[model samples]
Target: MMWTKCLCLLWALSALCAPVNKQRQRMLLISFDGFRWDYDRDVDTPNLDQMAMDGVKAQYITPPYLTITSPTHFTLLTGLYVENHGVIHNMWFNTTTTEKKPYYQTLFVNEWWDNGSLPIWITAQRQGLKAGSLHFPGTSSSYQGEVAMVREVEPILYNYKNETAWRENSDKVMGWFRDQDLDFVSMYFGEPDGTGHRYGPDSPERQEMVKQVDRTVGYIRHLAETHGLTNSLNIIVTADHGMSNVYRNGLVEEITLSAIPGFSFRDIAFHLVDFGPSGMLLPKPGKLETVYSALKGAHPHLHVYKKEDMPEHLHFAKNDRILPIILWADPGYVINGYFPVQFHKGEHGFDNQEMDMKPFFRAAGPAFRKNLEVGPFESVNIYPLMCHILGIEPEVNDGHLNATRNMLVTSTGTRGENRSILQNTLTGIAAVAGFLAVVFVVVTSRQILKRKRKDKRSGSVQHLPEEENTKQTGF
Candidate 1:
């Protein structure tokens, strides 16, 4: 009986710590780079609108601070802030080696990626599930010396030509799912981002690109239905960051480093410049104060900060890779260095708290709840939700499942309701065990009392034969 009680306690503990089963069979994660949160509102996105109506939609999803391409996208994959993930900026610069790798050049380098946090695809693969990547950043590189099973790291030039290119990529993604039998897959489309860069966000060209990407969305839906993967697969559509117009009255605001009076561009030991909205300035030996003073109040639109004095909310200043001085441009502004001034019509990599920097998030499939319009959430929380759907345990990350768990549904029920059911089950088991214990004590006491009463009644009158034998012995 003691062993039985111990067994019940052990069972309860096991129930509390049980592993989450795979939420669904397949997940297809798609990214539309620089697709603003409000783009669908301005343009006709019937397919996207229908998906929102049928599944879940977020009003907006805020990217992490330093809202750039590589950092935010990797944050979504790894669930870590830029300071922790080490993709501090789109471009890579090694302070120790004095090596500067351009933004596009770092795409193929393995060391530039492979931050300590594992992306979802790599996590799935490590857990014995097959995974694939189609031009998604960080997927090209190996994690802990292991790569995805099926990967296409071709340059972005090959993938984003026009509407046809998007459709072809969608077809290939579907093929990988159907023919290759992959459990997890990621795909990327460089759209409206490039278009917005060429033409301002409000321009007709950007609107047309929006429509083109919408068509691609519809085509992917058609393929999923045609191949009978609609119900079996969970499709997530999101973006790295949103685009903001940078041109005003036909003039671009370019902040040139050479224009600063006190600082010389030659004195800079390592300079990562020409990237819009944000750049890092490392001064030569004994020139830190001079560089900071030169750029601190030089421009009306540019905001400069010393590494240690950076805003606490940004979570950027703690890393060693961050240069001595950080420069940030206000919305609709640009930052430049010794390089020739070229104006892009639109730009990102600004303060993520701004509305213009927020991105779109929509998802549909068996795992997500239907007809739900969730409020805006941080992009870091996305990693945990993806891990939950894949049924793999997430690594140490800054995200919380509670932030997005309500958007998902499981076979048991909504995740929250399923948790409630488990809690109730454990409670009910405890209640039953407690009641049984009380009943055993009561029944045992009654039996003992009955025996005592019978003995007392017998002791009150001796048997006739026993009395006669006692009298004979006395005589």
Candidate 2:
């Protein structure tokens, strides 16, 4: 009985300690800015192809509307729409301070980056796990007053001149995973995006950049294999958004805000323009109707909307950061006051529903299923999936685990099911132990009572025999 009780105690202790003894699951999220879904079809990416065959690949990952870098990337991290997260655009006017901050300038301000919803890294850190980021958006700012354990001190710069930067960053990330033992790590690459902008998406330069990016992937894979972490490490390669080619050779008419009648730049208190494919105007004081009417049908390729009347599907209307009037350009058109002498050959920041705006998503690791092709899912869904793989509870956000659950092996038998099974098994063992303990006590008590009765009866018989002998002798 004692042995049985001791065994039960040991089993309970082991069960309690199991999570602490198990190896921690590691995740690495990599983003290639402006990497379109079809870029792989354009270039040779054997490493990515093998990863897809070995793991899971999305048909396409749809980012939120106004598909720009900061907003979509932040959405992926936080699992919230732009309106909910408060990063309404890549560059928006901050009404609180009445200052206009562009994308690059917004990186330094906490107000622009720190939205209410916690990002995956911040959430992981809050749950006592370590996280690291290499130039990922939102890593630069503190979330709910907590920052990641490790992140780049300065904003990551795109060194087009230095081709070796990607490999170096990969090595740094691998070090964080293998040595620092970070639970989650995110890395960003500014490639193909830059190349696409400099020379259109279909240009040879963009294709070469794609190949170069693929080589970087191969480098990271080789490092993972060398460290015996290929199976243990979950690596996700995705992009913020995709790129679209813009017509800049006068093949298509240029649309500019300045061309609109009564739409003088002086009438705007603060505005966001000159950036391609979209524009936001905050009319000075009461020029709202005048500005809106002037820019409504100003160009054949442009579409204008009042902030409240913006498409509900875009989820971009409710935020205060969104200006009084929003502008969208067609796929091949660029929206600016004047065509620059040096304009980007390609651009983004259009309606996300367009196929050209879809980004690529591929993941490989122990947690993900093999060779699966799924999705046309919202990019926001990635947050919950990431939380599931890392074994952390996700925050309240716009994503659902069921959307991407099919991509994971454990999802076949749901996590709750596995947990219930474990609980049932442990409960059965405990119940059996308790039953044996009760039986041991009952049987032990019965044996003690029986022995005492036998001793008492034997003494009475011995005494009787002694008494009979004395009486017969009659001394």
Assess the local accuracy of residue 160 in candidate 1 as a C-alpha lDDT between 0 and 100. Answer: 75
TM-score of 2: 0.84
What lDDT does each candidate get?
Answer: 0.82, 0.82
* Model 1 spans with C-alpha error above 4 angstroms: 1-23, 96-98, 248-253, 410-475
Clashing pairs in 2: none
> Which residue window of length 10 is worst by lDDT in model 2?
16-25
Tens-digit lDDT track of model 2 for 30-118: 99998999999978899899889989999999898779888898888888888888877766466546677666667768877785778
